[model samples]
Target: MAAQKNAGDKDTEEKKKEKVLRRPPEEEIIIRGGKGASIRRKEIGPESEVPSGTGKVAGGNAPANGEALAVHKEVAVKVDHLSMKFNLSQEKLDSLKEWFIKFLKRDIKYDEFWALKDINFTLYKGERLGILGLNGAGKSTLLKAIAGVYKPTEGSVYRKGVLAPLLELGAGFDMQYTARENIYLYGAVLGYSKEFIDSKFDEIIKFSELQKFIDVPLKNYSSGMKTRLGFAICTAVDPDILILDEVLSVGDAKFRKKSEKKITSMFSSDVTVLFVSHSLAQVRRICDKAMILDHGKLLAYGDVEEIADRYEEMTEK
Candidate 1:
């Protein structure tokens, strides 16, 4: 019996030694190239200069001891109980003479219109949100509010870092100037310095593929050319937050494809985005989350794919 016990103990010792000879502490099994590869170093986080790992949902600030909490280091946008109000004239005057007479008498009447009411949402850094709604459903109003085009009638909006809004095609452009001159002018309007625009000049012109018409006056340029130029300049700067509102639908298919590629590339980067599009497929393809609004009211706000499903149901009825 003693000999049998000794043999069993020796067998256990050999197994322990074999275990120690296996994989080292420095090497970890990670899936790479469709197979597990031993990696020696920790993967970098999303906000890192060189991203090597997926982004963790950063937790909230100031947690009690032993308490688990979500805390992100930064917030791109926070909309708190926001509302937008506009007054539309109930009656139209026939001529300027009649309008002046009514204005002098203080008799112009309007109906109260609330484009947005008590809308609230928070956008985190490096998060992409898609806004879904039918026409006149206040999607544009919400985006415009965030873009600072329209002031909120109620609540407040807080934001950090530079905002690059592509709300309209050629909004700040000078039609009289040549496309080359307009590049600098529009860049300055977008808050870029002359030197900065100078540096991005070649890249912008190359992406727009408008080298031959660079010196042509912008007014003579077709809508597609204008859109291409505008898109190139806006995307040149790696903006902290980007707001796009149906801007891509204007250009031709090829230009649209190029624009889509640029946007998709930005999605991989650390850029917070607010996108409004009628295409549900595009929303699902790009957005991390989605929000649905109907007649100035928020219907649903959650995962992109789920929201797409709900939106389809809502619209079908």
Candidate 2:
């Protein structure tokens, strides 16, 4: 009996050793600087620069011991009881007259749909948070709410920095206008002055690789082209907080790689990022912390690796 117990203990020790061996090595983050364009590589540690306390829920759900609150050194984004309720029409009317008649008769009905419900979490300055979920999980809706594009039915979002949100492609562009004109228009929509846009105009175009088509109407551009232009313009501004929703996956493979590199370069500047992507591996690469949403409710939020593992399990099932 003693021999059997010793054998079981030996098996457990072997499994533990194997698990540690399977861990990947730490990666190096590249930092760029100077006119000479010198590059410096910093080893990324297992721990994040900013520690998200035990309260991984939205709105800083701190633990009773106050450990979570103590670790959150700087607050950048705070969501308080955030809930978005959309009144979806129960029936479709083919014509405006029909809708008006139904409305007048009090026959119209709407289904209350909550895209996000009492979501809570506090994001610290310089922390990258990856939001994970299946389709219709309200990831995009949460970003839109945080970006101030949608007003919540309950609670509020507090932000303490210049926010740059890249949500829908071609959102601020005028299809009738030229790409050059839309650059200015979209820049202005993002709260950049004409002078600021002027300074970054050439760089934006060069980065987008749209020099030849700059004068062409935006309506003539493809979805990927619009994504490139929007990404270039938004990233040029050096925003305090960057909001992204699946913009990285639209372009070709080469352009996608370039854009990923661009985003990686920005990490050294300590920009707070809220990213929603379908790629779990991408999330693990880009984010230190992550949150999981299901049916518009937050299920898990914490370290990226743990959340990614949990998300993978969910997808597999």
Candidate 3:
């Protein structure tokens, strides 16, 4: 009887351990979306530790070590010690049985891919920050993290107001639905109300220039047409913060100019902008401040012209 009880206790303990191991991590809280969404509040904590050799800027614009950053201006966005990590499997198992066997045997290995590491920055209201990086430097990953599409592995991003993310335009559209149907569906996905969408419905259709084909299924619409519609819906209302990821050239040259004009018109307001563009000249034109990322780490951040010059040097190398 004593031996049986001990065995049962051991089994129960093992089951408890398994349950603990199988439990998922905490769900990441996504902030508000779309135009006029209220910002969520997070308790501000001490500044996060910066990685070694970071926080340097050209022209001596950055605050010195141990020097308090002068921040009298209202902050629009703050990214604190932000890090994004992914566990890439070392080997590909053919089936679920094989994967389970490997998992039970503790034979599965993973490669830790740090997409963004120890990134820190702050943007004031009405400032445009251009993000510059080579391919795979984690520019898009950083933007996604800020947009709350991907939860950070460490740290946090705080924003003051509504955010309109123009990343992966038309990503949420239903291919089987008509353009008219998708306008309402996609609008709700962005946190807009039916009443709000109803008011902007015609404007969105007019801007997309899909009047004749509004009743046609989205599956039949060309990729460019879908992109134009997505752009029109997202930009229908002015947002407090706008995140742009390689979306300047959405459709034909004419539509592209129209879209660019719409974005530029927002700058005259007090909205904060985070822009990522491969064109150095475009970044210089659209941003007053800039930052560069190399190998998932912040390399340089400061005045736009200096960073553009540095980016040119990096490209030449």
C-alpha positional error of residue 147 in candidate 1 after TM-score superposition, expressed in Å: 1.2
Q: Rate the local accuracy (lDDT) of all candidates.
A: 0.71, 0.75, 0.76
CA RMSD of each candidate after superposition: 18.4, 17.4, 14.0
* Displacement of the residue 125 alpha carbon in candidate 2, Å: 0.4
lDDT by residue for model 2 (1-317), tens? 11112233455356445533222212222211123322222222222322234246444433323555435455667676778888888777879999999989999888999899888787777889999999999999999877776766777665545577888765678899999899988887776777777878999999999999999998999988988998898888666678989977878998999988988888887778999999998999999889999999989887788889999999999
Top-down lDDT ranking: 3, 2, 1
Q: lDDT per residue, candidate 1, 1-317, as tens digits?
A: 11112233555356445433221111111111112322212211222222221123212211223333213335566666778878998888879999999999999998999888787676667878899998998988888777666767776555554567887876668888998999988887776777778888999999999999999988898878888898998888777688999876778898888899898888776788899999888888888778888889877776677779989998899
List candidate 2 stretches off by more than 4 Å: 1-72, 93-96
For model 1, the stretches where C-alpha displacement exceeds 4 angstroms are 1-70, 92-97
- What value does the lDDT take at residue 198 in candidate 1? 80
**Each candidate's TM vs. the true structure?**
0.76, 0.77, 0.79
Stretches of model 3 off by over 4 angstroms after superposition:
1-70
Per residue, candidate 3 scores C-alpha lDDT tens digits across 79-177 of 767788899887888699999999899999889999999887877678799999999999999999888887778776666556788998877899999
Provide the clashing-pair count of each candidate structure: 6, 7, 0
